[model samples]
Target: MRTVHEVSGLAGVSIRTLQYYDKIGLLRPAGYTDAGYRLYDDTDLERLQQILLFRELEFPLKEIRKIMESPDYDRDRALEQQIALLTLKKEHLENLIELARGIKETGGNTMDFSAFDTSRMEEYAAQAKASWGDTAAYKEFKEKAKDRTSEEERDLGAQMMRIFAEFGRIKDTDPASGEAQALAGKLQAFITEHYYKCTEDILSGLGRMYAAGGDFTENIDGAGGKGTAGFADKAIQIYCSRRGAAANCSMEE
Candidate 1:
């Protein structure tokens, strides 16, 4: 058994953090001394090690806790997975460093630029999970997408852009018109087929994102033409409203 102080020193985790983990039922001590000092045994230390590993992988504390407590939790398998992921991250960083060195040596202008072309969908998915860490929809999407090949995800993304381009071509149509509504239905079905369940509310949120003037807006415009994002957003709003769901795409008719 080890005191919290000893554990903190050996684990390189702060005593305060240990206390917080204990308070949250994330990492509890094995027992307490007669004098009331917390004592952690080997099993507790192993659990703490797992917690740190998950933390290093950028998993939220809640998600980490749920994963550790799940009946299917396998310590060795989890550690192996962590090692592989960290190895990939290390390799990615090394590649970036080498590219930087090459750019520095060559004055950067003659750079091949292919280093930036790496398929990083997994990295982006991790980031998205972190951003929407607690959302059920995000969790469902991640779960469903875990087995998808990078090439498959790329193809699906391309298909979605093509559909957006189709919307762009018909931008001048009335938002509630039959043509626009049919396209909106196709969009909803496409998302539901490839991603999460595209409820009306979710579709409306996506519509708002389409017109929010960032990467999504740029992609829509690039696909369908200028003003396509706004048109799609309005059409989506009309579609959702017609379905009697609350719509967040606030563009005027």
Candidate 2:
């Protein structure tokens, strides 16, 4: 059994956060100690790990609670999806790093924009469907994403690269600055408009994926500096968190 402080310290979250999760029934204690203190056993710890993993994925607390409580929820399947998404995010980040380094070696920006590798989208989609069955949200989001041609997606990619370049020009910029935060808001709107519905939980999760995961962290850092991604992620999080959604989403992926 572990005390709240010990568990929270290990999880890199505050004790208060755990208490709040408990309060919301997102993660309940396994038992109580002699002094009536919460005691977390192995089962609780396991659930906590899953909750933390989803939290890192930017799931609102409520969404995570629903997911955890759902009888059909498959932990391994969801974890695999999170791992794959994080891996893709990491690879993209690495590609940006390579591009930046290449520009440094060369005299100017070599405009070779083949950074995205999309040959596996079909296979991945098939696998996801096989694993998760047919989810309305997943199907809807993917279909929306499919409406764009590969070339259009590339243009969007280029537009984002341009944004990163601007961030590089102002690494020490304040996240709350009109320029930076405004751009952040623009990015949020863009995502919300095109890809998926921008619920409070979805927005927060996507924003956190920009930092909590290593691939996201590396991508944001490689684009500008260590600061830009952190700032953007925080700004987005704050914006989404204030909307009062508690991450109660049930999207397949």
Best by TM-score: 1
Residue 177 local lDDT, model 2: 63
lDDT of 2: 0.66
Q: How do the residues 135-204 of candidate 1 rate in per-residue lDDT, one tens digit apiece?
A: 6676677787999999999999999999988898889888788989999999999888778788786787
Candidate 2: give the clashing pairs: 58-205, 60-246, 60-247, 62-246, 63-247, 63-248
User: Which structure among the candidates has the greatest lDDT?
Assistant: 1
Give the RMSD in angstroms, all C-alphas superposed, for model 1: 12.7
**Alpha carbon lDDT of residue 107, candidate 1?**
89
